[model samples]
Target chain A: MYRYDEFDQAFVAERVTQFRDQVARRLAGELNEEQFKPLRLQNGVYLQLHAYMLRVAIPYGTLSAHQMRKLAHIARTYDKGYGHFTTRQNIQFNWPRLDDVPAILEELAEVEMHAIQTSGNCIRNVTADHFAGVAADEAADPRPYAEILRQWSSLHPEFLFLPRKFKIAVTGAAHDRAAIQFHDIGYEVKRNEAGELGFAVYIGGGQGRTPMVAKKIRDFLPEEDLLAYSEAILRVYNLHGRRDNKYKARIKILVFETGADVLKEEIEAEFTKIRASALRLPADEIRRIEAYFAPPAYAIALPGEAALAAARQADPGFDRWVASNVTGHRAAGHSIVTISLKPIGAPPGDATADQMDAVADIAARYSHDEIRVSHEQNLVLPHVATADLRSVFDALVTAGLATANAGLITDIIACPGLDYCALATARSIPVAQRISERFAETARQADIGDVKIKISGCINACGHHHAGHIGILGLEKKGEEVYQITLGGSGDETASIGDIVGRGFASDDIVDAVETIVDTYLERREGADESFLAAYRRLGATPFKKALYGAA
Target chain B: MANETARLWKDGGFRPNPWQDWPEDGALEPLDPGTDALVPLERFVADPDVFLARKGRLGVRVAAGEDVAVLAEHLENIALIALEFPSFADGRNYSAARLLRERLGYDGEIRAVGDVLSDQIALMRRCGIDAFLVTHGPTRAALQGGRIPEVRHYYQPVSGPEIEIPAGSRPWARQPAA
Candidate 1:
């Protein structure tokens, strides 16, 4: 909910003009594709398989209703009337002409948004917990710190071109909704014994061909030293990270190759020299940034428990939605409502223009004119009143945005695999669609309980299949699409990479194969109270492997 | 032996490059008076006393992987440090240039030597590389014409003076006056 000041405004506006010139130069044949590639990528334009996909950054996954409307407008005018929200909490327009990019950027700038650093080997969009300020268990709102990082990393002079793309995620809550462990650098907001705020810094975490849970480089980095410390980490990685092999270019590999202790020593040495510099954030600046993220004004009203129960009694559909979608808020009578974008048989995160507009309208009317995009490919109304939940749900129904499957089995996270991606070896969207259709019944999904089915078309793991409770990785085997299943992965506070179960199944049998695994879990669960993840933890992968591959 | 238009942009303007590239493979020799020879760091480290005895201005060339820390003690004596970008995609030199300016406070010409393209000119300049040894014809023309598209406002405080937000002006909310 941070508004861009004049400096930030001018910074984005000038970048748009600069990119406009670059686009013009490329169009006029003054610059070839090889030269123009990095320029276009830094501005979030990608040459995909079918068309050029333009990804727009939604910083810290927060947006105003006006901004959402502008996104809808852009989707309607420039793209194919739809936008896919990516796992990084950003949105992608799959179809946009090269000439229209500048125009699109201009429009985005008007709404305090741009596609800068959405792609390319640079510091990418800094993500944080979607429920930053609103979550009950939050230690602090990580948005201000994330924004500070966004400012520091945007077109950072030395880090413009890194060994590979760098990702940073911050989580302020006890629960890691931002998937901090899977990022290049993860910051967890913490308070020291003396009650002074700082960060628990984790470095080298990433998931691609190689998956790694970030290693804790610093137990507690004082909040004042955030930028300086980050600069040190980047400086170390920039100078030493492998450039010869693109696959081994991430900071994770560097930490693996050089060992964390040596990397820490180098970073500490760099930090010691630069910590006292101007990059040390002034106390006033921290306070100034924090002021922007102050909680929205709420009326001191009675809790909506009675009314919510009454409404749930009246409509079973609304009851199901409330059960799955609604989350507790710090303020009374207010609730965090997740608008599930993962509808049955649709692309995991695709929202049509009408759906976007409707959500925008609902956010303005029911919520406090604010919207949040979750890393799990869902939109969040962070401050919806529990009293207005039914109204919000009704509007969502009108736009077909209400799926009522927030953490349910059908709430899948998938990548834009062979459908639109040039890196994909197999199709991912169709696989997600098949699974969703098979478990379309609300009762069945509710019965199965919280099981995340993440799919990626290749080893890139853009779909975050490594963190799914039921991860499905699609690989091309001798020109055939084969689906490999992994069990018991999670992206929460206790993050772990899932283990692959035996041999992969053919694409035709993958859905049935997944069903057998789910059925096995249902039969073997310690009652319905235990979720799939909990059950898997208790029973381990042996049973699941046996269910999938027929008893070894 | 480069042409006149093939000049280095130093201290905010174009100036003729005085130093010639060190021979790729040859015997090391003493430099001519008043001339600068850009020698590789490895070659310089092999015999530091020999390079030190030269009468001409001294410049050290660093490859992408070489440590910039080795030049800390020699900062005052070195007139220029030319960092190589084997390809435009390899950005290790950017960090090296920044370390020279900010960390070591080396107040000499830090030139970006090889594979320097037009798009990267502004970023390299921001990282405190004051000079460029550009070989691309159009890139050189663009540098001479001052046609490099650049954004004046920056969010981060790097090697340059940051746009100061006046005290008590709510730095986060204060809009720039038109």
Candidate 2:
């Protein structure tokens, strides 16, 4: 919830003007498509399957009610009456005309938001744990450092045109909700033995055609050296990362080719040269940024526990939701509420304009005017008082935003696959819809227990299928759409890429295949208490493969 | 291709290019004795001793992915280091230019050649390339119009005359233009 100062305001305003000029140039044929592509991409405009998609950055997944309203307004006016929240914690409007994009950018700037660095081969929008400041297990709030990085990476001259697009994620909590391990660079904010704040730096992690869990290059890097160290890492990658083959261009490949130890030595040498340079974060500046995210004053001695329990008992639907969607908060009498976008039989993460407006209102009323978008494609009301849970649930239910499947089998994370993306090989949304419909029974889902089903349209893994407990990748084999399954992947504190099961299933049989795998887990689990991931880890992929492919 | 009519922009205005490219047709060829001629890095590296011993001003054109360290010790002898962009999106030259200035401390003229556009002007300047050999028609027009679209308030401290000092307590924020 950082507010924009004069300097920040000026920067965004000028960027709008610059983008306006670029658009005019492209329209007038003063620049060709080849020249205008990167320029447009930097501003987050993408030519999708049907129309130009505009992705707006939600920095660190934090938003104010006012900003959320503006996004709702954009969806209503410029695009279709809904927006798709992506796995990277950003939102994409899939139908904005090229001529309307500049105006859209101007509107975004009014709310201290812009599409800058949301795309293109640059330091992209920085993400952090959605529950950064309010999480109970947090060692430090990462928003301050994330914001510092956000400012530093925006239009950074030397890093704008890297060998490939770069993503950086930060996590302050012991639980990695940000999926930091799958990013180009991941930082875990923690306190050292002496009680000083620093980071355990992880580098060269990403998922595309290749999936990699990041390597911890530095055990502890002082918080003051954040930007300096980042610069060193980027400088090394920009100069040496592969460019001849686009597939091998990510820094992860560089880390693989050069070996992590040698690459670490090179990065360390560069860090030594610039550690005390102008990029070092001054303590006062860090404190100044931190003040913006300081916890709001909590109401003392609120009577919510008894009322919350009574409300839950009164309504089984609300009780189920409370059990699944609610999480503990650091402050007393408060809870973090996850408003599931993955409603039964719906396109996951697509929030209608009305739903957005309703969520904005709910956030203003119950969550101190703040909302967060999680990387799992869900919205979070981070500071909902336990007393207000029933009322919040009622409001969300009215807006069709209340889904009692937060971490359950039906809470799927899927991408806008062949239906929207130009790069997609097959359909992903339809498959997710089918699976959701197949498991629509709440009781059945509860019986099945926690299972993550992530679907991607192509090998790009935008849906993060690699991290799914049951990963589904949609591909075109022999000009026929086939869904491949991978099991045992998790994106949490213990991150691992899933392994592919035997052969893929056709579109017609894919839903049944997923059901078989779920049923297999239900039979194989130690008990209902044993989660799908835990069971998969304990049992490995053998039983699931047999369930899907038979014991051949 | 290297355009002979392409304008050279230095210190904020367009000027005539003093140095002519060797193999005027822009081919990879053996270097011949000449003054004020810009040759490819490969030709110069083929025989640096011979090129340094010649009686002429030397300029080396570096490809996008060429190793910049090859020019480190000879930076003093070179008058201009032209970093190629092959494509505007190929940004390896930006790193190469920064290494030339910040790492090697090569204060001599650094020129951004090939695929140079107005949109990239501000970034190239920030990376310590003070000279631009612009060929794209619209970019040349933009440069001549003195309307290079740019964001004056920068977030990173880069070496260039275009930026002032870091404003107030935020060392990351470069002050806006007066």
Indicate the residue-level lDDT of A292 in model 1.
Answer: 91
| Candidate 1 lDDT over residue span A66-148, tens digit each | 99999999999999999999899999999999999999999999999999999999999999999999999988999999999
Top lDDT prediction, candidate number: 2
Residue pairs of candidate 1 with colliding backbone atoms: none
Model 2: per-residue Cα lDDT over B54-105, one tens digit each: 6768999999889888988899999999999887878899988888888799
- TM-score (C-alpha) between model 1 and the true structure: 0.96
- Give the per-residue lDDT of model 2 (tens digit) for A1-552: 799999999999999999999999899988898889989999999988898999999999999999999999999999889998988789999999999999999999999999998999999999999999999999999999999999999999999989999999999987898888898999999999999999999999999999999999998999999999999999999989999899999999999899999999999999998888889998888999999999888787788999888888888899989999999999999999999999888999999999999999999999999999998999999988898999999999999988999998889999899998899999999999999999988888878878999999999999999999999999999999999999999999899999999789999999999999888888998998899899999998888887777788
> What are the lDDT scores of the predictions, listed in order?
0.89, 0.91
Real contacts recovered, all predictions: 0.75, 0.79
TM, every model: 0.96, 0.97
Each candidate's B-chain TM-score, in sequence, is: 0.81, 0.87
Q: What's the CA error at residue A380 for candidate 1, in Å?
A: 0.4
